[model samples]
Target: MYIPLFDIDGTLLKGGGGNQAHKNGGSYAFRTVYGLDDKACWDNIITDGKIDKQIILEVVEKNGISHKKALAKLDEAIDATTSYYLEHSNEGTCIAADGAIELLEELQKQNVPLGLLTGNIEAIGIDKLSKAGLAKYFEFGAFGNLALRRVDLIEIARERAIKLVGLQMTTSKFMIIGDSTLDVKCAKDGNIPVIGVSTAKSSSQELAEAGADLVVESLLQKDDIVKFILD
Candidate 1:
């Protein structure tokens, strides 16, 4: 079976309608857990499709939150961010993107191996999907909470898919589907093909420039996508 690794936030659900609520929640986590309120600290950083700890570390550095102290409070800060994220998703700010449910259902019918490859901490990622009632579509995933880099997370996804789904083939047989250039880059790193969906901030043109094998405006055509991937 071909393996398809899906991204959660932008690819499946539109979290906070493109980062407003999510960023607000992260800022809250930084202040409450790390006391980072310097607006300048967050100005230069881009959090979308980023690892949970990486974002916190950037905030720590930017806000002058003693690296040592930040390290000490890493777990707590991550917890706070994830908790806030869960709260927002629970509050109905995040909803399934258009055609996302239909696409997932169609993929499931093909009996393709489905798993999540997301930057969200495993709990937060799964929680977002769970809240949207889409969690049942994924059997396993490699989450940001487990790795600090999306590239590393991709490898983790491969290993887990192998273990859980009997994914018995070279990594090239796998496909990474996501909405950001980061996803495209990591899939390239693994020598895996990436299918870009424009459900997130990246326009189809942007994702194409990033070297996505296929760029779709949205996951609206199930047969066409499934056919191309399977072929």
Candidate 2:
């Protein structure tokens, strides 16, 4: 059976106050851990398509903290970030992207094993998905806290999927569906097929250039997407 691993932020959910909630959470963490008061600290950082830990390290390092000390405080910062996001994220603002729920439902109906592969830490990702009514579709996932790179996360997810199915599935049996160039590159690097959804940052052309096997304008093209997966 083929397994599809979906990206959460832009690919599944959209236009939620989730982004603000994350920034607020990150700011709170920085304040609590590093004494940084600037709430807009992440304003200049390129956060899209990157994992939470990588973002944290970049912010702390740029603020003059040594790598060793930052690593030591990593768990502390992550906890603070997760706590704040959980407290502040508004469920009402969490909107499912166009056709996201429908496509997921169809895939579920077809008995396609679904999983999440995202840069979001587990807590925040689950919170957002729950808010968007998407958590039920995924039983397990490979989250950002597990790795700094998306490619590594793919490997981790593949291992977990194998354990879940109790089968040694080849990497080709896995597919990544996401909206960023990083998603395409990571899937390419791992030698897994990737479907790029142009629902967030990257355009279809950019995703294709990044080596995506398929580039979709949105999940609205459910028939085509479903056929691709089944084939």
Candidate 3:
């Protein structure tokens, strides 16, 4: 059976302004942990496809904090950011992408294993999925806190999937479903097939150009998506 590892933010969930909550949490962490009060410092950094620690380090370094200092405070900052997001973002703030749940249901019905490979910290990712009612669909996840680069999560996810399913699945037996070129890049780096869904920031053209094996406008293309995965 094939295992599809989905990206959380854009692939499974969208809108609800929960992202603002994450930004607010990051700013809060900066002020509380690093003593940096510049919200713009946190806001200006591009966070796409990067892990939480990478984002935090970038923000702190941009504000003149040394790399060592940022590393020392990284865990605390991540905790603060997660705490703030969990406290602020509730079910109302997480909206499942169009046809996301249906797609999961169809895949699940086919006995395909579902997992998460996302740049979100574990807690925040779970919170968002729980809010969107997507948490139940995923059996395991490789979260952002586990690595500094998105590509690294691919191997971790594979190992975990092997353990969870008790099967020695090769990279070819796995597929990545996400909405960003970063996701495509991660898959390419790990030698995994990737399907790009243009339901968020990155467009289909960009994802195709990034070398995604398949690109779809959205998960709403359920038949095409399912066929790609099973094939």
Kindly provide the TM-score of model 3 when superposed on the true structure, using C-alpha atoms: 0.94
Q: Could you give candidate 1's per-residue lDDT for residues 67-118 as a string of tens digits?
A: 8888788888778877776667544455888888898888888887688888
TM-score of each model, in listed order: 0.87, 0.94, 0.94
All-Cα superposition RMSD per candidate: 2.4, 1.6, 1.6
User: What is the C-alpha lDDT profile of model 2 across 11-87, one tens digit per residue?
Assistant: 99995568788878888989899887556566578987888999999998888789999989999999999999988
The per-residue C-alpha lDDT of model 2 at residue 180 equals 92
In model 2, the runs with Cα more than 4 Å from the true position are 164-167
Q: Is candidate 1 or candidate 3 better by lDDT?
A: 3
User: Which wins on TM-score, candidate 1 or candidate 3?
Assistant: 3
Q: Compared with the true structure, what per-residue lDDT tens digits does model 3 show for residues 1-231?
A: 458999988889885457778878888999999999755675567887777888889989989999999999899999999999888885247889999999999999998889899988899889889878899998888998888778888888888887886657777788799998889998899888899999886999999999998899989999998998888
lDDT of 1 at 213: 90
Pairs that clash in candidate 1: none
Off by over 4 Å in 3: none
Task: Using lDDT as the measure, name the better of candidate 1 and candidate 2.
Answer: 2
Q: Against the unseen true structure, what C-alpha lDDT does each candidate score? A: 0.78, 0.86, 0.86
